[model samples]
Target chain A: DQQVKQNSPSLSVQEGRISILNCDYTNSMFDYFLWYKKYPAEGPTFLISISSIKDKNEDGRFTVFLNKSAKHLSLHIVPSQPGDSAVYFCAASKGSNYQLIWGAGTKLIIKP
Target chain B: EPEVTQTPSHQVTQMGQEVILRCVPISNHLYFYWYRQILGQKVEFLVSFYNNEISEKSEIFDDQFSVERPDGSNFTLKIRSTKLEDSAMYFCASSEDRGQGHQPQHFGDGTRLSIL
Candidate 1:
């Protein structure tokens, strides 16, 4: 199922620059959207999430913007550091449902 | 901080052999889940358990697959017969509550299962 899609396979950013990763979903029932960061050989770590009722949520250098009408969301990492280099996955879930529709991750690389 | 724990970081077994992956969810968490990620593939949800019963399951969770909370703290997933396609990293996760606003699930490092 291609419900969620991250069109960018990879992204490169200079240290201290901004990295914006985009994701789109086809399912309107998805009320919760989350971003996860994963490193090699490890499980995904939750980064941030945005509910459909809200348009934006931010935590430190990371910010998630949700456009429910457009069925799109984006994760912005400001002052990107080398530690931020990893695969970022976008996931969406319907209310009260445990299943999360995941998108093909976008690999982010930070250059010094 | 409390975190989910999973045993057998890596396992290699012959095809058709049964394999059981174990997990211990967070102490105060009430919802348990099992998800898998094949190499180069997106994470896929297998099943979710709440109150000792399966609340929801995905198409991938078939008769060959079963989940149980044998004890108070442990949640386990069993594959009756393994196939080559079953080789993947199985992850266990838990949440404080389900469908109660924005409760994000915390995940374990995962157990990598390999079918030979």
Candidate 2:
């Protein structure tokens, strides 16, 4: 079920530049959204999250913007570094449910 | 920082053989989960465990699959009869709580299961 989608299979950004990754969801019941970063062999590492109640949430160099009306969300990484190169996943949950619906990941490559 | 951990970085099992995957969730976390990802697919949720019982499970979690918290520290997933399609990377996760304002679930470096 394509409940969540990350249209871009890969993204490239220059070092010290900004990187934007987008995600869209078709489920209206989803109220929580999260962005996770994963290395080749490691599991996903939680980066940032936004609740439907808010439009934005920021953490250090990472920021997540949510547009509920359009059912879209994006993750922005400012001053991207080589260490930021990894696959990113967008996940969503509905109400108090613990099950997370995931999107096909986007591979972000930060060039030096 | 506390993090979830899984045993046996990779496993190879014969078809129809039973295999069990083990995980140790973060201490103090009340919720635990199991998810799997095939080579070219999105990570799919299998089941969520809370208070020593399953709170929710997906359609993929059929009669062949079972989850158990046999001890205070370990959560396990057992597949009664393995198939070629069962080969995938299995991940374990834990969250401090669940609700409208829920905490993020932390994952471990997954265990790769290969059915031969």
Scored by lDDT, the top model is 2
Which stretches of model 1 miss by more than 4 angstroms?
none
The C-alpha RMSD of each candidate to the native structure, in angstroms, is 1.1, 1.0
**Which 10 residues in a row give candidate 1 chain A its minimum summed lDDT?**
A93-102
Q: How does chain B score by TM in each prediction?
A: 0.97, 0.97
Clashing pairs in 1: none
* DockQ by candidate, in order: 0.66, 0.74
Residues B1-116, candidate 1: write the lDDT tens digits. Answer: 88899988998989999999999999998989999999888889999999989999999999999999999989999998899999999999888775477788888999999999
Count clashes in each candidate, considering only residues at least 3 apart in sequence or on different chains: 0, 0
Highest DockQ against the true fold, candidate: 2
